[model samples]
Target: GLLGRYTPLDNGTDTVDEVALLELMKKTGYSMMQENGQRKYGPPPGWDGPPPPRGSEVFVGKIPRDMYEDELVPVFEKAGYIYTFRLMMEFSGENRGYAFVMYTKREMAQKAIHMLDNYEIRPGKYIGVCVSLDNCRLFVGSLPKDKNKEEIMEEMKKVTEGVVDVIVYPSATDKNRNRGFAFVEYESHKAAAMARRKLIPGNTLLWGLNIQVDWAEPEKDVDEETMQRVRVLYVRNLMLSTSEETLQEAFSCVRPGSVERVKKLTDYAFVHYRSRQDALDALRLMNGTLIDGALVTVSLAKPAAGRDGGGATWRHGGGGGGDGLFLFQRENGGVEGRRCTTPGPPGLLPAYGAQRVFPLPPGTPLSPSSLQALKPYQMSSYVSLLEHFCYQHSWSPPDYYLFSTPGPKILLIFKVVLVSTQNSYLPDKLCALVEDARELAAQHALWSLGTHTHTHTLGPRYAHTPTLTLWGQGTHTPAPTLELKFVQELSIILFD
Candidate 1:
């Protein structure tokens, strides 16, 4: 059998102490027998070596969570002459309770094992050792809430073989809930190798949960600024033949300049631009555009920084403040201009009787029934109803209304009428209208149900009213109220 030996100090004193060495061998699990004139001892034929180097390579059994290098080093040194020792610490300065110890000499290491193996450093705790390699495994985290053990196992199965075991950590307080982490073990090294090859970070599911894999070591907390500068772009729907160069060519036309580098990933390509602005421009212009007959989507190149200040500001449609205005000649022979503004009436309206009259229609006119119904309300009620109606439809009322008030009291009377009609039928009519609109939206799979209130009012009075009283007559029912609330709640479930 080959003797597994390690040299501690190259120039250290070497003298034979056969008797003590032989005795140590037997205690440490090595076999020994006297032959002719010399005594020879070797590891048992089937012994792998020190039961696989416990704390050094594989950490098993409970150890103090607060164990540290300074504390652990002395204990291991006393057990065996330590050559190298390290206790892994997290970036936040927390001890990982793991330490690696190397004996000054393999013989000394073996000697220490005889004296210390199965001997508790602390009561009831024994240490083990094994040969360690540099390769380390990491656990991926932040899985979706709805993801199950079976689904995760299926994903891992694609990369490895020999299903050994997979343990999903659950919330300590909630057994049925995941703590967003899991560990997988394989029967063979090859299986672990396969898993490492297949499971990568940023693998997304329909619910927007990302799958991440890492070595089973504590990670350094990255600086916020450092994270901001890095960006990841996940391009999808890419042409199969598209290479890094092809993607570079497609994004090369971005106005703010081209990508700094492009790389082809598993099924897509990652593009890094000189600046975030360049990346944003590329996303806006290149996304959904045909690239070799395939529609490619462009997104941020890396995980976005959690801090609000770092991301690139994306401007689309046009450049500069005045770019969006459209200038056209109107039928009245005057030049007219239009631009997107707050949903209300146009801010810079032409005079009521100007030559152009702006040509743009005023915000939707109140129906005759709506005006008549509001006849009994006070001016405050009218204002409240108008505000509610505007908000419910996501509309903004005109800045100025062309009202012909006969007197202050008459004006008040007219305002009251407007409020009554609006309050009575507006919510029911709006709900019906929204339902119709929602139906249309559903046809294209574009609608997500949302809710306002039964009567779209700003103050507390509106909140406490019977659902029926707000909508008036046939429209009054608890169904729409419950339906709206349910829709709001269901939206969370649907998206999640």
Candidate 2:
């Protein structure tokens, strides 16, 4: 499968299973293949007969990454006819970074290695080739207690190339079963080194254990308490298309032989390095490299919880008020997380009677002859000044709307809407604002006595202003209950 169930076919479906003969021609520089009657079906002159058997297989590294097997075949076919091709893949269907190519003859296999080895398939990227090693050695640990030498060697061989011998260390209590570790010998040093780098980190689970690997012939066996753990890198948001091989290659390019172990999970992975410095080197090169079409992020992992005071997480507060309203959040001396709310414009205030309105006198209607005696006030001018005052306290600008005063001496009733952008208001602070507004009105020589039966229509949207007459009967005595009520309504809307 080429990363997905379907192979990209030349037929134009971009499908799977069908090989990309054209891509092969372009990369390998040849197209002819002898078919049924000794006739070449392709355009160029090429090799004779079908591909060879499985025994003549060779491993190729650093494939022009993200290429499907069908396309990769041509890159190597330049050396010989492909018998069988296997690009090892991760469980998620991503290439493992290396592939095995079987050819028609031993000579052809050798030819491929020489011609394709270190070939720059793409800019700054080259292919590496290796013949299967016949004798090599490796260390394996975390084996099940019942595992035997033969079983361990067989298992390792299934994943690695060339294996001839194995040694198991048994527990003191029994010779029949091992103490969870063993040594494996391959056909050559090359094979041993390959296994050491690829398998030693032991993120791959085997026989139910995430087995560990190192040289059984160790440089030293220090006490467990004195051993320092390997530095690990945390990689996240891996695309399902990313292969273990691609990731490993990216990290290895940073520092050769630094990546010791890799364990991949649903959308993340962990890469262990031999040393912290080497891990940092790997991070520098691979922190944002794209693999399988997705950019991956890499960082050093923090120690697990309980290691260094259990890792505290802090979040920054949003500050003051936000969104459609503001909340005046504060922590009282003893009580915590208390908040206040600000009121909206008069007509916009909640169903409660926090808003007041007054109507113009019926006999004193608007006329050009009478206009000279009345003073005009800009809506925004006063509002801007009021906003400047409240903002210092972290509140939003108030909305002051003026409708004609009805049946009265020419007085404009401006509804002072001290809207809290943070959706909160302190009672003390709100009253202070009302007092300031009254003073400002008086200073402008447009002051009107506070009273009931006031009616006002600030704009065209409101056909008529609601009458407020309760204050005359002493039913609403609280100073600026309108402001407090507005704040209460805003708070309800905010918290709800």
Q: TM-score of every model?
A: 0.22, 0.23
RMSD of 2: 32.4
Clashes of each: 29, 37
- Candidate 1, residues 167-267, lDDT tens digits: the string is 66434234356546566666644455455545543343323444544334222223334455654354655655667787878787764345665655323
Stretches of candidate 2 exceeding 4 Å from the true structure:
1-56, 89-97, 104-107, 122-125, 132-496
TM-score of 2: 0.23
Output the worst ten-in-a-row residue range by lDDT, candidate 1: 408-417
Candidate 2 residue-wise lDDT, 51-154, digit = tens: 45323656666564355555576677788766656564433334545666767677777788668767887788776775532224455644677988788878
Q: What is the lDDT of residue 366 in candidate 2?
A: 62
Query: Model 2 — which ten-residue stretch has the worst lDDT?
Result: 314-323
